[model samples]
Target: MHRLSRALLRALPRAPLLRQPPGPGRLLPAALRPGSRGGLSTRPRREPPAAPQRPAAQGPGGEEEQFVFPEYVAEPGPAPAREPPAAPGRPERRPREKRQHRVTGRPDPSVPPSGVSCSGCGAELHCRDPAVPGYLPSEKYRSLMGGQPGGSEGQGALGRVVCQRCWLLVHHQQALHMQVSREQYRNLVSAALRSPPRHGRRPLVLYMVDMLDLPDSVLQDLPQLVGAGSNILVVGNKVDLLPGDSPDYLKRFRKQLLRSCAHVGILPAAQGTGGQVARTGSQNLVDVHLISAKTGYGVEELISKLQRSWKCNGDVYLVGATNSGKSTLFNTLLQSDYCKSKASEVISRATISPWPGTTLNLLKFPIINPTSDRLFRRQERLKAEAEKTEEQLSDDEQKYLKCLKKQGYLIGRVGRTFQQQKSKAVIEFDPDELSFSMEEEPVFSSNKPKERVEFTYNELKDARWFFDTPGIVKENCVLNLLTEKEVKLVLPTHAIVPRTFVLKPGMVLFLGALGRIDYLQGAKSSWFSVVASNLLPVHVTTLEKADSIYQKHAGKTLLKVPMGGEERMKEFPPLIPQEITLEGIGTLEAVADIKLSSAGWVAITAHLEDKLQLRAYTPEGTTLIIRKPPLLPHIVDIKGNRIRGSASYRTKKPPPLVENLKANGTNKQIKRVSKI
Candidate 1:
């Protein structure tokens, strides 16, 4: 009978599921009850006795069909600290107590051992575990800590003491990554500003800015934190990614930078006929220099300038947001091919890597050149002497020429005496030579040299001493938003070759599945140019297909925005959408640029006919910033054919601003269906 009943149900069309009440109401209507002639019950006319009410039971799907409410959890309390047990033979090392200044080396009757800072990476030294940073073997740590600076004649006595991790990284170019928090960065910036320097040296602040990711708001914060006593030198790093050599573009960029800095209360340097700063009406003093630490472009001149200006022994503090190239710049500043630091000899422990937070602790390296101010004075004397003819010289000048002859700086030699008198390979300086060329090849810090120093930050004596601090984790930068591989795709290692697209109404452009731009409604076909890492992929699709393509290919192929690999990244989060409406300041100005946080931006070329509308999409919690194109040269170029349909393209476009668009969408979707 049971088999026959199952067969009959299968033979019949599917019936709708029904909810039955408790007690007498539990019985379905005679016509609708199961096992009835027609899904109805004839025997159900007899009802059961009253019973205690119970929680509702699920239907056929059981627990799979029902949702259980999760228990609420309160906020987390302060973390508890645990100390690992010690092994025999080697005693357990306790957490380091606070100490006096590493630079001053003056022991506070208050603190002991000055808590070990890795002479290599500057992390506090420890021997508890090899997996953690600043780890050293117990015996090695004792030997290093017990030794004195310049203990013996050999370089090993004065060798740099690095953690085992830094030693491996320097030798093998490996990365032992760390996740740094923003609060730690705030502490470092505060310390850099408030920490007193050695007696005679003034604190010269080098605030490094990542040219590609610098926002206007960050520029403003620089002045407030760096107190008025310090002179601020802004280094716009990663010029290797900036495009073009057009004077017109540079002219525009200079003005834009000046304007932005002025907006932030940081003024350009005081103006003279040939002064570095032009009167761009700003309150605080600043000098800007564009450099490429990766390529060693413009760094030499910057070094010479800084070294010449502050003749007084001044402490140079390198401060910048994470991935701002501060470590690279710091390394380059200390690189010397001369006798002291050889290409094969190990020197600094400041770790340089694409991985954010690679630098955990503050590290310092002293570049105590025996002849300091004398090098600059000699260069000045040589330049003056080089400009004069042999007959145009006085007896004193002749004596100088004779000295230059001894130093091999004659009419044929251009930069033979450049680095210094004590430096192994000197600059060959010839009177007729227009450019200064090094006698030996130029050395770069990127070349991982063998280990050399055992010294700490204590050896620096006020002479442009470089203090490397922790990297600040930026919240919106694609580097922070994307995973390690994704960051490589988004950050340009070489010059950025640009990509551009032309989209009609209803078309959308997906930037490596990380971001999307919908051309909701425009006067005509819209042209959008993109400038970012050449390695990052871009794709386009209709608004209807964009959602499906993104949902399907997200992490597998469109891998830019996903935070990690595996199923989590493949499950692209639903985009948090926003509609941007643009308006022009001028009657004729209708176009504007919209930025996608650390991702590149798009400039909308709109007609005055109607205000353009743009719908932007990004992962939830990710910041999407819209601003005018920055005053950067070659941020965008229209030098490519319009890309349409489902293909991706590249072009160069600078980031800044545009105008006149009406945003049309809910936070979830635009929901606008315009005429096709």
Candidate 2:
């Protein structure tokens, strides 16, 4: 019956799962019922509980179901520090008491037995450490301390006793963590001595410089840092940011870098040519290499150098600025796995955020060489010491001090001056305040010029005056005078209106009465205005004694004021002569009014026929108004075009002496008559 029931259920399309079968096998045992206990019911007996229904067996097309289950993670707690047995032969020195003593033999207090000889004058050590007598912390002790200071809740609850020598040594080895003083930096021979790492020998030192920031001032002291024998390789690390991939562009960059170094005082390494090293004049004894850390392009060359040169597998110590990717390079070198087991370690005290200084007091590890056992060290310890010293010193000392103090001061003092230099201030007239008049109308020889719009006005009875008024504000407030390029003031967007000036032909305008006053030989005098006026392309006439001209020479030379109603010329007798001395030159009256009909125009004709060669008409192939016409000025064939006839002697206006010879004479005849 059960087999037949199962077979029938398998054939059904969508049947609800039953919790229990209404059969003898589905009933619970009699012992489980409270009614069966002692043949009496303690509570009313209920039907037996049904079993949980199972979902249908899943296949490729089955509806997937998920359920949240609590995960049980069994984390093994903090492991105890492993105690490696001390080496067999080398006897460990007994801890000595703290003692203060003078240093004599060696320059560096932290130098090993090998480098302890005096750099200044070769001498053997009298006291243990060269610079000072101090104790260094043991590797075991540093691990025990775990960066916890001698205070509450530390591994050393009572703070373990350490000698000054041991502590200094430990600090030197852990230079990456220590802040070195300026005194320490200056006195020490090598960075290693100041902050030696656990490694025994010097590693191939890579000196990375930000090309833009390196000044000769800072680079002068570079030789002292790495020393003479230690292979100091210089690398300009941001080559990727340089402009363009062209060989010429790269050459320019290299030349600029070399020149900048020379300016600040760094010598570069040997240059390569045609894929071979060549001796160049600018090459320094110090090796120089260019690389871009941003892209991992030249890093392999740097790694190859590190692998080849560093002795006793010396530590690859990268030292540079905060943003220089020192840590990134470090991580890359070590394949990013820092901890022996865990993914990351918690750094307690950080010099900077996100990136922390090396925390290991003396990170010791051993590597085997083909010949014997060796240790490869990455000495970030000295960098740590340098950082400490850097913090203690003023901020600019590392970067800008040399630039400001040495180069800036030198350049500033090279050319000294005692006498005050004269300065110029330009004066401009307000268009509204100006009034113009022409004594005579300008008559064109040709058909009325289509390019030039001409106008005429009556001559001025009084001498023209030009004034220098400062900028005007909306409230009638005037701002100080602004230079040509300067913006006087920012106006409210809605209130501001741009000004325009119109120049009319054959018109002389009286500006305001003012002249620029400047300093000369410490005295307030007008000289710059005089000198600068000569420099300006625009014609400017001084008005220092112009008023005298109105009193002296008014209407002397056929001057006339044409009234609108009469159109008559009124002749006046001379109050004074035409010439007067002011500023520097003995200036004469400008008989005719001046006007600029056009701002200026250059006719761009192609000469498509090629018959004229363009030169027959224009000397420059395009004419300057002051030099040639269709403008007023007479045209002289400067090139003297062989194809065209010699230019006629035509003048824009005849000279003042010849204006009276034939007032109605043609301009060409007037020019010829004046020349004769």
Alpha-carbon deviation at 484 in model 1, angstroms: 2.2
Q: Considering summed lDDT, which 10 consecutive residues are worst modelled in model 1?
A: 667-676
All candidates: TM-score: 0.60, 0.25
Q: How far out, in Å, is residue 394 in model 2?
A: 47
After superposition, candidate 2 runs with Cα above 4 Å error: 1-190, 193-203, 216-218, 245-286, 310-316, 320-324, 336-676
Model 1, span 119-148: residue lDDT tens: 666766655555556666655654654643
Residue-level lDDT for 232 in candidate 1: 63
RMSD of each: 26.1, 42.9
Q: Candidate 1: where is the Cα deviation over 4 Å?
A: 1-116, 129-132, 136-161, 164-180, 197-201, 216-220, 269-283, 311-313, 336-346, 367-464, 559-566, 570-574, 583-590, 607-610, 630-638, 641-676
Q: After superposition, how far is residue 306 of candidate 1 from its true place, in Å?
A: 1.0
